[model samples]
Target chain A: DQQVKQNSPSLSVQEGRISILNCDYTNSMFDYFLWYKKYPAEGPTFLISISSIKDKNEDGRFTVFLNKSAKHLSLHIVPSQPGDSAVYFCAALGGSQGNLIFGKGTKLSVKP
Target chain B: DAGVTQSPTHLIKTRGQQVTLRCSPKSGHDTVSWYQQALGQGPQFIFQYYEEEERQRGNFPDRFSGHQFPNYSSELNVNALLLGDSALYLCASSYRTGNYGYTFGSGTRLTVV
Candidate 1:
């Protein structure tokens, strides 16, 4: 009964390469999507977000793409740096209370 | 300003004991939400407080309760702690009307033996 799902448990990429993390959601009422990056002993930090109205949103080295018809979204980071290594969580904003439903998370490792 | 502050960064308790965790919201934020994150799992919503009242709640049991002070700070209290209650508790703060996202605290780790 997980509303949001991250199929991949982890991902590895070389520095200067592109890293892609994927997520899926079962609820169609989700109109807003966000990505968060978390480091050890720290809280999740908001990365980027996209409204249902838009198919994509980009910020600096990070880009988020949403496909409403497929109920899927992906986060792309170009020129991945070692500092980018952390856990990534995909969250959806929906439900009656507009609370965020989060995916399990994908740990990203960038090797320099 | 400070983002969100959670107290007693870590705690250990025995079964049947009770525990209380505290949270201070970010500057100018009026809404407080608590979440529980178990091992290898994402954070799950426990409840949310706005204007000193419980505005929304998740599927947690009655053993989990909370309160919000007039200053927008919050406390999460759990009664009759069980071994399963061990997890990292997170507190998030945001504007009353804005639900787009939140600012989260580092979280308090609670261990029930």
Candidate 2:
């Protein structure tokens, strides 16, 4: 069973627009949520993260909002740039060692 | 400094063959975790190693095994490989006490025919 899910396979947006990616989870034990950006032929790079205790966290242009009651979270990139195009994977931190459980990932393309 | 480094960027093997993938964690990181990413899908956890011991494991079968050295480097071994085992193997590193994030390597792509 998939604990985390990202239903959207791809998204297209214009540069300088806001890009929003959504994720949902089935497990309530997940206390931390993270977003990672991956480029072609490369490993995922950490983006932003939010703890279950907090509803929102922001780092520069990247913001993550977590809704514990809904078991859902989202990553928003404001004024998205062309370089922001990549596959974004939503992951949850759980298990005894806090192993990451990742979603299928959403491919975002920003056009100038 | 260098981030996580994985060796053998790509490899191809026949069914039933065995392969070994290596990883070197980022400087100052003590914990290492392995993940497998198939095409068109996200990464799935395999196992984790710390202080030369396997600390956590995922749902992977017995064919997947790993080892960690005294220097904090790691190796992932897959025996009796099947075609379904073809995928990208990634290595991530972080502090044992911190679960905030991980530094990932470029990954090694293994294709089993």
- Strongest candidate by lDDT: 2
Cα distance off (Å), candidate 1, residue B102: 0.6
User: In candidate 1, which residue pairs clash?
Assistant: none
lDDT of 1 by residue, A1-112 (tens): 9999999999999999999999999989889999999998888899999999999999999999999999999999998999999999999986566677899999999999
Q: Against the true structure, what is each candidate's TM-score? A: 0.98, 0.98
Per-residue lDDT over A1-112 for candidate 2, one digit per residue giving the tens place of the 0 to 100 score? 9999999999999999999999999999999999999999999999988989999999999999999999999999998999999999999997888899999999999999
Q: What TM-score does the first chain of candidate 1 have?
A: 0.97
Query: lDDT for each of the candidates?
Result: 0.93, 0.95
lDDT for position B49 in model 1: 92
